[model samples]
Target: MTISLPVTVSPRLSKKASRHLKERFIEFLLFGAAAISVFTTVAIVYVLVKESWNFFQHVPLSDFLFDTQWTPLFDDAHYGIMVLLSGTLTSSAVALVIAIPLGTIIAIYLSEFASFRVREIAKPFLELLGGVPTIVYGYFALTLLTPVLQILFPDLPGFSLLSAGLVMGIMIIPYVSSLSEDAMRAVPMSLREGSYAMGATRFQTAVKVVMPAATSGIASAYILGISRAVGETMILAVAAGMQPNLTFNPTEPGATITSYIVQVALGDLPHGSIGYQTIFAAGLTLMLMTLVFNLIGAWLRKKYREVY
Candidate 1:
């Protein structure tokens, strides 16, 4: 008889249900926001594949990959991506060589040795380097670093990979140092104390215990630095000549894939034309190169990340 009556929910229960529904709604919105990134990545890959498929129809894959020259504007256009690939790798290699040691040293100094005041002063200024405009870096490379290199290696060209790479290295120093320093700082103070208890000097503790523990993050920083160098456009475009040369010499002029894309975009090529579409192909190649670097970095991080 008591159950026969129609039951109405209590006001408190209704309010609780409403609040639960609101929480779920907010969660869905957050999930949707995260999903946007995946969608964006998928969109990029789709566009690249679609246009690149059309491009490959006209140009053979072998010539694109293996040919030693990239003359997409020539009467007999060659789609040799190797020329650009070499230049890109050369500058990136140079950037890594300069950035890795210097950035690591800076990170160690900041994390282990620097006074609080020095860390406060230097960290902000170092981060400021990353905020500077790429055009300024380009100009610095063209006018400043190139001149310095010209003094050292008098035979260096006006626009050479060396100058561009050096400036690019300077540009990425903040990325490497900031990340590596943060990783080193994340090491438990107890670990340093333990090292000291074992009769280890500050340098030995930092090099042996902290560095090994922070290897994953340091490796990530290095990979990201290389990625930044490879993807750089303005510095290379302005300082490194637009000529795509397949040489290992760092003092020579060269064009990276990004530079080539920038050069092509500056012109008034019709949409859907071969010249226009070639940029997409180059972009795809650059994307793949960066992807490989990221994959390698990810693998290293996974393999080396410490439980602590």
Candidate 2:
């Protein structure tokens, strides 16, 4: 009788239950985190789109999109975003010109050629640039950087896009260099050895073999760096001035979208006014542009990860 009753339950079934419970818990945790991030992102986009729609309801979409003059403070309104877009792109492009080559070169030296001691010293110094408060960079760009650039281009405007862009570039160098170095370091030692065995010089191996391997990662970092440059506000606000000039003159004062938002917020612009709503629309535009950059970066990283 005892033997007959014993077969109904087994130790295997108990262990299986425990493992199933643990796996479910882990799955729920992962799903919860992803859900939270997705929900937050959607919520933000929803708010921006909703508010921006309200803006467009009163101010025609065509005028907002096409008007050259960005005078949002008129009975006959022209909510042209081109001026703000111009400012954002100008600052980002200028920062890119300064950041890309320098950061990439430094990353190469650190990952491929620098002695251990030099890397130890330089890594901390570079990371320190990122930690410095953006507001401080703003102050420096306004007071010190503007003066220095003015001395070089004395005929140019003091608080110009060039000055803000340069400071923004310095701030972003840590981002690009650190990420690019990681990408470079990920190349297999065997590959480098293989190239060396082929009688290639160190420089040739680094330039051809290592760089090709790491190109995707480097491109991702570069795109993210540009996103940072585009989103920057304080340095542009303080050093680039609040003039939203839709021209490519780097030597002239120009305002970015963030700077324009700051200018609008600081003034006592009434709620529900075109001025108040314009910032939200501009913000939505900025968010969309940065989102595009992030998407491109992610794609590049996924593509180039194994090509080396």
Candidate 3:
């Protein structure tokens, strides 16, 4: 009796089978990556809430929110976050005031007015400013800009919110300009042609047509710049001072939430201690502020996105 051997087919022997398997494998990898990112964000939120809860249990929420002082390291420790919040807002406001107009002007020039040669030359230099180290910017604020400001205003402190904010503004300029320019450039050339045909000059077309078309993207860029200014650490720590001042004076030394976190991190505080927990609580607040900015940015992009 003859016995027939069973036949086995290799997947590679069939091109369609191999292609199907490869597609499924690639799909799995993409899904895994997306899931990891989602879970990572969830994990971060969970950790922040858990640690912040522990902190609030020890310190009353009212005191943390409303107290005018933030001397958490002192014997008569106060948990007031407003002092830090004031400094954060003050510096951020200054940064926005400086960055918004300058950045928008730069974007407009690059997108509308600059010749191809000029734009190519200018954009790289603008982006180069962003590549400079934050630590260097901090030092520049501390040594160069602060002295110059002191010359202008004799009463300004060596480390003031004004100097820090100015330097931070300089740092954020590229981010705003680059994003806004890209948005403005993305506006269809047809819009410009239409405007030109209807008795519009280059300036008029850019201001009336392109600006409105790219408003959402420009707004998102500003929001991201604000987020950057808020979350910045080294520059604020180096030039904005570590003193928690409740006043909104730019010339005064003040601590931001970011500065406070840096201060705590540099110390040798024991794990799970009140001091350690303080940083976590402050971190959660910072996280929430950034989250709000990001949410607003996403909403603006969705609401105002131009199909063209």
Relative to the true structure, candidate 3 reaches a TM of 0.91
Query: What would the per-residue lDDT of candidate 1 be over residues 1-308, giving only the tens digit for each residue?
Result: 35687889987666687788999999999999999999999999999988899899999999899998899988979999999999999998898888889999999999999999999999999989999999899999999989998999899989999899988998999999999999999999999999999999989999999999999999999999989999999999999999989987999999999999999999888989898889999999999989999999999999999877
Best by TM-score: 1
- Candidates' lDDT values, in order? 0.93, 0.88, 0.93
TM-score of each: 0.93, 0.89, 0.91
**Candidates sorted by lDDT, descending order?**
1, 3, 2
Clashes of 1: 0
Q: For candidate 1, which ten residues in a row score worst on lDDT?
A: 10-19
The sequence of per-residue lDDT tens digits that candidate 2 reaches over residues 111-229 is 99999999999999998989999999989988998888777877877788988888899999999999999999999999999999999988898999999999888998899898999
lDDT of 2 at 123: 99
**Models ranked on TM-score:** 1, 3, 2
List model 3 lDDT by residue over 224-291, tens digit each. 89999999889999998898899898889999999999999998999898999999999999999999
Which scores better on TM-score, 1 or 3?
1
